[model samples]
Target: MKRILKRRVLIPVFIIVFGLIQFKTIDKVNMVVPAEFGILTIETPPKEVGELISAACFDCHSNTTKYPWYSNIAPVSWWMKKHVEKGREKLNFSKWSDYSEEKRDSLRLKSAELIEKKWMPIISYKIIHPEAQLDEDQRELLISWMKK
Candidate 1:
């Protein structure tokens, strides 16, 4: 009788835990404004530079994020939120106009330096996002764009 009761409780508990693990929630927020509305424009950046930056950094640094299916999971979503928030705070490309000219130049140089050092996409980020692993050619292109 005790063994049967134990099995009943354990089965229900396991099911509940599994169900909780499957539950997902998503909350997205827009964080960009027009460059004209602020103090900058994308007119200076080359098309390739813009494309590379978008593909590699826009998810965390822009108003819109292309959330992954895994991002729907609970713990992963929570972590992603934290990472995105911090990344945006550090350097929001979408809000480039809001920064002072000095800040803008400093950020541009930092962006170039980070890329040349193979540190922009970050190793941990590339581990999960293989497409972000830029080749030597891509790196050179970014470096050249930055120098301009």
Candidate 2:
């Protein structure tokens, strides 16, 4: 009798807790802006190079990210939000005009170094966003542009 009562109480408690957790997860999603990178660099690269950068880097490292369907889900949305926030914190292409020349140069060098090491875009990101994976030619284009 006690076991049956305990089970009844535990089930409802679990359901209530789960509901609360799902609700709490909703707040983790950061508000997205309508505009993207207004100005990604001090000097715009050629159109081809610009496109390459957009495909490979802009989603995370810029002011804009086109959230996919999965991004609407709870934990995934939370994780993606944090990732974009961190990425933007590290390098916000949208804010290029705000950076001083020395800062831009330093960031370019760092960006190049990360790309050379195959550390940028991150593995998990590439797995889900295969379009974001940079081919050798694309990599070269970005590296060259950064150096320039």
Candidate 3:
């Protein structure tokens, strides 16, 4: 009887707490995405190359973030927003033109090295976004392009 009473009290309290928390939310800020930025701003690679880069890199590296449905939830949205903010801080690809030639070149080289070593597009990101996985061909292409 005591355990049952405790469960009854806790469940409703948990639900009420969760329901109240739902009031806070995040919005999609698609308007801020740069219309004409990304890897293309650096050079016009082949269609496949550009596609591969955009699929894997744009979400975090650029201002153009195509958020998934879960991004609307408060805590999850907050978590994702934190990631996006952190990613942009490390490298905002949308503003690629703003980078000096040397800085851009160094960054490109670093990106390629990470992909070649399978360190980038980190595992956590790949788990949620399967499309971002780089096949052997894509990996080789990026590595070769960076070497150039």
Candidate 4:
């Protein structure tokens, strides 16, 4: 009887907290991406490579994020917003023109290394977005293009 009473009280409290958090929505103001400043504009890759990068990296690494439906939820949206912010801070493909030639080259080398090690398009992202899941051939193509 005590366990049943405890669950009944705890469940309502959990629901109330979840609902209250919904008021604090994530800021989506930085979503607009100008095409002229993007990496594709400066150093255009092969079609397949471009497509692969878009699928696997753009959502977090670029300003033009295509937020999924679940992003409307509070804690999840908060986590995603922070993740994307960190990704952009590391390398914003949307602001690719701002980086120096040396920086760009270094970033490319790092990208290739990460992909080769299967450390990119992280597992959480891959689970939610199957398109980010690269097969051997696709991974090889991206790695080659990044090196080039």
Question: Which candidate wins on TM-score?
Answer: 4
Clashes of each: 0, 0, 0, 0
Candidate 1 lDDT, tens digit per residue, 1-148? 8888779998889878867876656576675476553212554566776777778887777766778887877778878877788888998887777788788778878888999999888777788887788899988998777756
Model 3 alpha-carbon drift over 4 Å, by segment = 1-6, 31-37
Candidate achieving higher lDDT, 2 or 3: 3
lDDT (Cα) of model 2: 0.76
| Candidate 4 to truth, TM | 0.94
Question: Whose lDDT is greatest here?
Answer: 4
Candidate 1 matches the true fold with a TM-score of 0.76
Error of 4 at 81 (Å): 0.7
Alpha-carbon RMSD to native, per candidate: 4.0, 4.2, 2.2, 1.2
lDDT of 3: 0.80
**Among all windows of ten consecutive residues in candidate 3, which has the lowest summed lDDT?**
30-39
TM-score of 3: 0.84
Predicted candidate 3 versus true structure: per-residue lDDT over 80-135, tens digit per residue: 88888888788887887778888888988998889988988878788899999988
- Tell me the lDDT of candidate 4: 0.90
Ranking by TM-score: 4, 3, 2, 1
For residues 83-120, could you state the per-residue lDDT of candidate 4 as single tens digits? 89999999899999999999999999999999999989
